[model samples]
Structure formats: structure tokens, C-alpha cells
Target: MGLEASNQGFIWVVRRNNNVNGGEEEKNEWLPHEFGKRMEGKGLIIRGWAPQVLILDHEAIGAFVIHCGWNSTLEGVSCGVPMVTWPVFAEQFFNEKLVIEILKIGVSVGAKECNRVVERIVKREDIKEAIRKVMVGEGALEIRNRAKKIKELATMAFEVDGSSYCNMQSLIHELISYNA
Candidate 1:
């Protein structure tokens, strides 16, 4: 799909495994080699792991294929990039709900169980459909607009008068009082 002409403008980035969490180290090393055989000349950029913040920061990033972790969810939301949600774990399902159902800023890739162990596989058609909806399909404009609005709110949370900022100050004052 990535090598297709229509997807030329998009960059597909993937994280193969978690070496830190005891993912198969040998296979993890070899997986990239195998991956490079197909994706080296193509537009895909595969890595073991890197700071998602850096990738999401790019303006060209339209949608994120995320496992729906809270941090990844926040990064995608705060950056105003709509998501292709594939949540696999406990809180991640809730995060997917928050994005797709509550926040209305993303589309689901329909990953029910955890893919870490391959209980369920999100197929190519599912991926293509989600990507199309996010990048160029019917809901693209609505998704993008909602994401921009969310980005604004996420930004305001960090300002001096924002909820997050005030909450931080309150926590600090409480800690000081306790020490005193």
C-alpha cells in the first residue's frame, strides 16, 4: 500500500518491537533487515522506537497509527493529527474510546485484542480504509477540523492561566505546606 502512487506523499513509520520489554532481540534485529528489503526505496521509515513527539511535530503528518497508549494519544491529540487507532491493552482501549467516541478526533482501525501477541491482526484493507478516511476519505475534513480545535485546547492547558499549569502550582504549594 505504501509503495502505491497515491500514497507517495505520505510517510509510513513503524515500530517493529519492544526490545526493552524483552521482545525477541535477535528477531527484532533481523526484522528491520527484512523490512528494509521491501521498504528501503519506498517512503516507509521503520525504526525500533523513537520519541513519537518528534514525528508528530511534523506538519506533514496527517494521521497516526497508534497503539492508543495515553502518551501517544496525547501526542497525537495535542499535535492535532487524527489517529488510526489500534489499541491493544487495558487503558489503551479507553484512550481509543476517548479519541474516536468522545473527542471525535480519530478513526478506528478495528484492533480489538492486543496485537503484541498476535491474538488479532488488523488487515491491509482495514488499514487502507482507516488511512483513507483520515487522509482523503469522507470524514477527513471533519477529523482535521476537530483535531485542530483539540490542538488549541491542548495548548491552552499548558499556559500560565491554564488548568494544567494551575494544577501544577497547586501541587507544588501542597507539597511545600506538607514539608513545612
Candidate 2:
């Protein structure tokens, strides 16, 4: 959805799933090359692996399209970027619920049960629909608002005197006492 419309004004840097189509060779070359030839400007940046900090730290990013993996779910939450959830396997479905139902900062892009041996292809239309709801329609604003609030909380939790910081201090103090 984002890439197809990149030339229209949006700029996107997409990390193509390494195991796209469940083990097929990475198609990372095709997207940017194709878009580069098709579009006049630098509108898309597609790669096999993502630059996590580059994406998360960029202020221009408003939303994230994610597979709802545990690490990525937390990354999005910590960054306060609203997400479009698309889970594949393992506990990803549970993570999706946390992002969509519990956090209320992300929206789901429906997926059926995944087969490890089979390749599942999501239609571009479906991708567009989910993105549309998140980027423009429905509860987009609310999702963004919640994400911002969570970002503040995430920042506080990691800063000095915050919950995580205090917990770490307590643990360190206990360990030092034992050594003494």
C-alpha cells in the first residue's frame, strides 16, 4: 500500500521480509529498482534488513506496518508509532491481540492460520484497506493519540527514577550487598 503510492507524495523505507513467501529468495532488489525506474524521485527505500533506529527515530514516521512479533510489537510501542498488525506464527497472534485489543494503539490486518510449509500471499487490496483505516479513516486519530501517550510512558520508564530504572537500581543494590 505505501510503496505503490510512494510516488504520489509519501516517502517509505520498507524492509522486505527476508523469508518472503516462506523461504523464497528475497525480492528486495525488485521493489526499489522497479520504483526507481518508474518514479522520478527517491520515493522508496527497500532493503532485506531494516535499520531499526533509523525508522524508529525518524520523526516523519506516523505509522508502522508490522508482523506483530514480540520484539517488533514492543519496538512500535516504545516508539509510539501506531501499527497495522499482520501476524504469521508462534506467539505472534497473541502479540497482535496485545497491540490491537489491549493497547488500542494498533489496528489488525486480518490473517488466517498460517501453514509453515505453504506460502501465504496477502492481496494488495487488503493491505490497502488496512492501511487506509489506519492512515485516514476509522479510529486513526485515537490510535495515534494512544501511541503518543504510550511513547511518553515508555520514555519515562527507561529514564532515571522511572519504573525500570528504579527496578534495575534495586537489583544492583541487592547484588552489591551480597558481595559486601
Candidate 3:
């Protein structure tokens, strides 16, 4: 239902890192193969892990479809990119809550179970609508601005006298005093 309706004026770019194993691999492999075939040429379907994909950070990537993993969320947030969260397991559900409810950056597809044989799933139309809803709406600009502010704050935190820097210095001094 969702996949079929998801793609319209948007391309679904998919990637999977090698670190995930077990049944997750079985599930992940099937999606890229199946969905990639459908989206090939029309969109992009990348397999394996590549840091260069972060370069998508600069392009006109209107939204991200992610698992709500913390690192992935941070990267997307750093890029000021919105997301369509589909949390698989672990703390991902909490992360999804933050992205959707707290950050107000994106949407969730709800807790829908999908199968391997399911064709025409999460298709072009749905993706197009989701993209439109995220990219063209009223709160998108505000969300983007807030994300940019967080990014700046993160940068500032590492500079001299910043909270993070001062904390590190305090830790070092404590260590030295203990050693003395």
C-alpha cells in the first residue's frame, strides 16, 4: 500500500551497510534487489557501504527513508534533511519519536509489516506524496532552520571555551590533579 503509493516525483535511493547481519541481512538484501530493480535508472539503488554517499548531504535530497539508527539520524540532521522513518528494532523507535515528534523533521509510515514477495510496495506515488508533504509544506523551512542551528551549535561546542571543550579540559585537570 505504502510503497505503491510512495513514488511519484521522487526517486528512492537505497543503501545498506555491511555491518548488519543475521535475519536483518536476509531482509535487507531482498529489498535492494527487489526495489532496486524497480527503481533502476528511474532512481538509484546503491549496495554496500560508502562514506562518499554522505555527499548526498549537499545535493537536492528532499528526504531520507531511514531506520532511525542514531548515527544515521545524526547525519541526516547534520545535513538538515528530513526523513521517512521506518524503525526496525532496538532504540530506533525512540529515535523515530524524536525525529517526528520532537525535531518535527519528518514522518513515519506507521508499524506496517512488509513481505519479500510483496511487489509494487512503497511505490512511486506514495514517495512522491511524502516528499511533497515534507518539502513543500509550511513547517519545512522552520525545521530546516532549526536543524541548521543545531549544526552550528555542534560546531561551536568543539571550539575553545565551548561547553564540550571546557568539559574536556576539566576532565584533564582532574586527571592531572589525581596523578599529582
Candidate 4:
């Protein structure tokens, strides 16, 4: 509903796991009736695997709605995309803090506790608000600038003489020496 109200083009990736309910039919019951028809050109829902990194790297992408897992957080940072963080479990809340408070590149959707998807629901209005906060108005520009700066630094870290590259080399050398 929030996505619909936001009036933004989105690509949503859905993964199916055996642990979700009992079967495929049951799992799909979560989606609203005629969701695809209603969304039409506004959204694309990709079932199973999607090339997440490739999708994130695309230029048209504005803000990422993320679960605040470490990998997804890093992907969003590297892609230089501001985020709407919705943390659910484990260290996700801490990751959300890092993105929202520490990095200043994200806004939280106020997801606090971990529970069943239905129980921990963030309201559509709140979701829309967070996304709007990150993607609209002058504040959006600032967040995008911060995200761009972070992306620049993240890109530099992978260069030949960059900090990350050097650290990786050192680790490999130490491992080889220890094994020898």
C-alpha cells in the first residue's frame, strides 16, 4: 500500500523458502488480490532469485528499502543509495542504527521488535513517510550527497593500493606464512 501511495517505480524481489508456511500457494496468500494488475507499470515483482547487486548498481535507482542485514546494508552503501531501513532480527537493528544514526544515509521505518511478518507490521503511512523523507524535499538532496560520498570512498577501497586491497594482501601473506 505504501509503495502504491508513494507513486514510485520499484522492483521488489521475493524469495521462497521451504520454511515459509507449507507450500507455494500458501506463501503467495500474503500478496493483496490483483496486486500485479493494480501495480502494472509501477512495480515489478521478481520471484526467486534476482541479481540484487546489478539492480542496486543501476543509475535509475533512488532509495533502497532494506531489511538492514549486514550484506544488504553494505550493498546499499556501496551502491550510494539512501535507504529506508526496516530491521527484523538478530543484528539488523544495530545495522539500522549504523545506517540511520551513524552513517546518516538512511531513514528508519520504525521497526523495533522481531516477530512474525504480520505482527511486526510497519504502517503504510509510516513507510511512505520514511521513503518520502529520503527521496523528496531538500533533505533528500543532503542524504543523496552523503550516500554519493560514501560510495566514492567505498569504490576507492577496492583499488590496487587502496586500504581494503592492502589489508587483504597482508592477510593473505600472514596466512601463507603461518601455513609454511
Better of 1 and 3 by lDDT: 1
Sort all candidates by lDDT, best to worst.
4, 1, 2, 3
Q: Which runs of model 2 end up more than 4 angstroms from their true locations?
A: 1-36, 39-42, 115-118, 174-180
* Span of 10 residues, lowest total lDDT, candidate 3: 111-120
TM-score of each: 0.81, 0.76, 0.64, 0.91
Candidate 4 versus the native: TM-score?
Answer: 0.91
Q: Score candidate 3 by TM-score against the native.
A: 0.64
Q: Comparing 1 and 2 by lDDT, which wins?
A: 1
Candidate 1 root-mean-square deviation in Å: 3.8
lDDT of 4 by residue, 1-180 (tens): 887777788998888656556665425667788888999888998888898889999999999999999999999999999999999888999999999888999998899998554477789998888888998956999999999999999999989999999999999999999988
lDDT string for model 1 (1-180, tens) is 422423534555555655687764535453334555565565555455666788788887888878899988999998999988989878898999999999998888888876666678666677777878888988899999999999999899999989999999999999999989
lDDT of each: 0.78, 0.75, 0.66, 0.89
- Candidates ranked by TM-score: 4, 1, 2, 3
lDDT of 2 by residue, 1-180 (tens): 443642233444555563645764655554535665665464445545667656765787767878888888889888888888889887888898998888898767677667364588666677677777777867888988999999899899989999999999999999999999
Candidate 4 clashing pairs, residues 3+ apart or interchain: none
Instruction: List where candidate 3 sits over 4 angstroms from the true fold.
Output: 1-5, 8-41, 112-129, 175-180
Name the lDDT of candidate 4: 0.89
